[model samples]
Target: MVIATMFDHRVADGYSANMFVSSWADITRSQPPSFLPSFRRSVLNARRPTIYTPSTANMFISLSKLPLIQVDQKNEPNLDQDSLRSRIYYIKGDQLKKLQLLASENGCQRSKLESFTSFLWKITAKYMEDSGYLDHVCNIAVAVDGRRRLSEGEGVEKEDLMAAHFGNVLSIPFGRIHSKDLKDMPLTSVAKEVNKLLKTAANKDHFLDLIDWVEDQRPKPLMSRPFAGTEKAVSIMVSSGQRFSIMDKMDFGWGKLVFGSCYAPAARRDYYVMTMSSPVKTDDWIVYMHLPKKHLNYMETHASHLFKPLTTDYLKLYD
Candidate 1:
């Protein structure tokens, strides 16, 4: 039941996968899907007059100047980019509920994905600290589906089809916390910080402003936060798959799809994490991570109880 899928990072992102798979299901069922793919460049076409917020301006400046997502810094010659590895694990609903309770006790509120992200963030910070990079910046770039937000930015009503528009519309918003501070912060506190930054970047106004910014920089390459810079840094980007309708939206005659998840390109340099739905377990989740081999080793030994490996037997793919 473990549906492992790897797509070109160029053609589709996390959000686009749902529609892509659903379309295939529709074809198999000989039924027309909800809507055809919309690749209209006009969707994200730059605005005539440019606009920007001070916060986004600052972010753009940092991305333009800093080496935020470096693979292997000459400074950290010991680390090898080719040594990166991938792992799949499941987080039980009960376990996630306990973590959420622990987070709530600290006077912070967050969704399951955010809570889990905070957990991973802390773990990553520890790895950096152990590697003597406590002062280094560690970034967590989160992928936000910008379709609804972008449609809203354009003053489209919620009842409008644009709200549910199918496209490659997305925003890469991130929070940069120093390793030392992240190491010292409480779990809930980290999640709160993450939530705040992501909210600003994922809101309707942000997309409007992003369009303006792109307009101002016409004819130039637009780079996301993670792809920018990272001379002395540790980073991870997480994408949430909470909204994908695995049970209903994907049923194009297939008796309820069992499971679905994304696999990143093998050659990707930065660390990545994806939280996905469990086909069988309603409250549980499947977390896929592409991270450093050494760090994966540490986590496997230290927190293996929490992140169980996904085997073919677990997926019931074989007899």
Candidate 2:
């Protein structure tokens, strides 16, 4: 059996999906959910005297202000709307360790997310190079959930049921590098750049600015950097699922959930990557990627070992 859910991205970001499911499960069992959700926007209000950090201002303004990029006909993917696709890939703990070791050897201390982002960024830039778009930009948007950051700053303790705090509390900070530089730069260096971009939004002020910035764009749409670029441009976003409570944690009293993943809507032109822990093997991860077929084909052809395809046998669904 399979279950699917749909939520308005503007209203509920990825993290909210878990709470929504858990709440439904609680009702089914005739038990009150551990905590209810709060949809208060004022909780994220900016300081009384409006202050703008340059970085925060740039992040919120540049994307919305930039003109939409246009791609010529030759660079377009050779696929009709119906032919768009998505794939599931798995990465072992050992593989991640190897990459980490490689980074350390190069005098870099990179986390799993940074390492993967750097590696994928290089791979994507390679595709651009191969397609004769060496000067084109390749950006990686890292999705950061602001719930923990906001709560901690607001003096909300760990034991506090933040289940009540709900809305689109998310900040997307991304890194952009042209294909030419990505090709010439080392993996560690590229990852370092990506790490730096992510750090810019890892604070209380940035999120508060994000909230106020959204308010400023009231009647207008907030277009992220990825969405502002052209179809040919490589704009991939990775939403970290390092702490997603799935599997045994999602038990609705019937039994533990055997497996879980995302449900992508119709056609998506840009790339999106998400990762979760492996239930069977500790330290391993299951990656879900939705991207252009050409990019997937290139990765599958060149780096197949790094991304294992999911199968019923591997997951032991029937066992």
Candidate 3:
């Protein structure tokens, strides 16, 4: 029972698309949908006073303040749509656990996704430094779902109501550091940085402020702050699909799902990574990556032990 879904990034993000797939699978199995789709716009209505903070402004940028395109990209080649590539890999459970341990050694509990994000951030920084962009800014962002966080203290009913709400209820909190500084940071320090960035958005106030910010900038285009600046920057977005539960919950009377993973079109030149649970190995992960060729090559060469290529042998598809 393998299923594929495609979404336009302009309309919906990965979280909203995954919710739709989960709900669709539940209905197909004759089970009550876990999340009933809610299209009410009032759920995310802007505040009357339109209050926002500097943190909200830092997360996103209005189109008006964008600087003119720089023509001095001598070492950096133009990354056209054709240059983007997609690859899939399987990460062993033990490796993930080791990363988690290393990331949490500072006494702060770090999730698996946070640990992995830290590792990738370091790798990206190294690549940038190797490419002679040591002083350039490198940013990594994690997509945080705001449903539960936004409804905190409102009671379970309100939380469930927000859970059932359909749309992009997401906030991207990112870390911006110089490639030289980030590359020199230890894994634990990098993980702490990742955790600190996540804390900025993992609360109710942040999302509320974001809603108000969007309202204040209504009718004008907005983009993530990392992508808006004219300074040399390399950005990547990491999303988690561990909660999708597709392998365990998406049975449509045919059989359990053998293998499933997301895909991105090569024409889309965005650097993104998604971590999903493996269908065969409960603890393992199937990483779907849309990154630059150089970055993927670096990962393959430097971190091959952690990222094994996905193949028929691992999935037991032929057997």
The best candidate in terms of lDDT: 3
* 214-296: candidate 2 lDDT, tens digit per residue: 66667676667565653345688888776767654676667777788885775566567888887767778888888767778
Please list the residue runs of candidate 1 whose C-alpha ends up more than 4 Å from where it truly belongs after superposition: 1-7, 43-45, 58-77, 105-108, 153-160, 163-166, 246-255, 316-318
Clashes in predicted model 2: 1
lDDT for each residue of candidate 1 in 126-196, tens digit (9 for 90 to 100)? 88888666467888888877777766634545324453455556667778788888888988788887777
Tell me how many clashing residue pairs each candidate has: 7, 1, 0
Error of 3 at 194 (Å): 0.6
- Displacement of residue 175 (Cα, Å) in model 3 is 0.7
1 against 3, candidate with superior TM-score:
3
TM-score of model 1 (CA atoms) = 0.85
lDDT digits (tens) for residues 1-319 of candidate 3: 3468788765776667767887787788888876677777887998899888898788988889898875666766453335678999999999999989988874677899999999999989998887666567889999999988888999988887787777778898999989889998989999999989999999999999999988888889888877665777888989898887666666656777777777887666668899999988888999999987877888999999999999999988884
Q: Worst lDDT window (10 residues) for model 3?
A: 73-82
User: Whole-model Cα lDDT per candidate?
Assistant: 0.71, 0.73, 0.84
TM-score of 2: 0.89
Q: Model 1, poorest ten-residue lDDT window?
A: 59-68
